[model samples]
Target: MNEMLLAAFALFVAYLYLPTAWLSGLRPAKPMTRQANHLHCPENKFYIPEDAVLRRHFVSQLRWEIEAALHPRPTDSILQRHYDALVTIKLEQRLADMGCLKPC
Candidate 1:
């Protein structure tokens, strides 16, 4: 049947690919490359301060937490996150002051 043939072909392909350990030993060792730890959070798109630069802020960390608690989805870019955080902080301060000021 077609199903049986397809299943057998898949198994054959998997068996051929799985034992790449033997092939690795036959090739030259890779040249030294930057270790994962040295690089900034390249893979973690959500990581704050994704790259190093002048005036780079790791503020995304705090912003993300606040956004997660207060808003959904969060901002994508560092600048957007920074702006959102600033707006949230300022609004909170204003609200706090307004609360303390008895009926105007």
Candidate 2:
């Protein structure tokens, strides 16, 4: 009985280690390709005009701020105010996009 239990335990350990060893051997031997540089346009071939890019960036920033405000972990009143300000800014941008408000 003791020998049987020892054999079973050894088999279980081997079963676990065998799959891990196999998987490690099957994994890619070489490193993956490096990530693309997101900060700048690739080779400067494609570009958005400065004014439009600035407007888009502003709208994106406001959208991000609004999202962050919505998920405030501590639920602070100041965060709520920041969210409201971002929403107001987004609304103004929308109005401007529709030509209802002149850009200042």
**Reference-based TM-score of each model:** 0.24, 0.26
Scored by Cα lDDT, where does model 2 land?
Answer: 0.60
What Cα-based lDDT does every candidate model obtain? 0.55, 0.60
**By how many angstroms RMSD does model 2 differ from the true structure?**
13.2
Segments of candidate 2 deviating more than 4 angstroms: 1-74, 100-104
Q: Which residue pairs collide, candidate 1?
A: none
Error of 2 at 55 (Å): 25
How well is each residue in 18-88 modelled by candidate 1, as lDDT tens digits?
Answer: 77897788789877554444444343233222356511443444445555565354456986777676767
Report the alpha-carbon TM-score of model 1 versus the true structure. Answer: 0.24
Worst 10 residues of 1 by lDDT: 41-50
lDDT of 2 at 14: 84
- Residue pairs clashing in model 2 are none
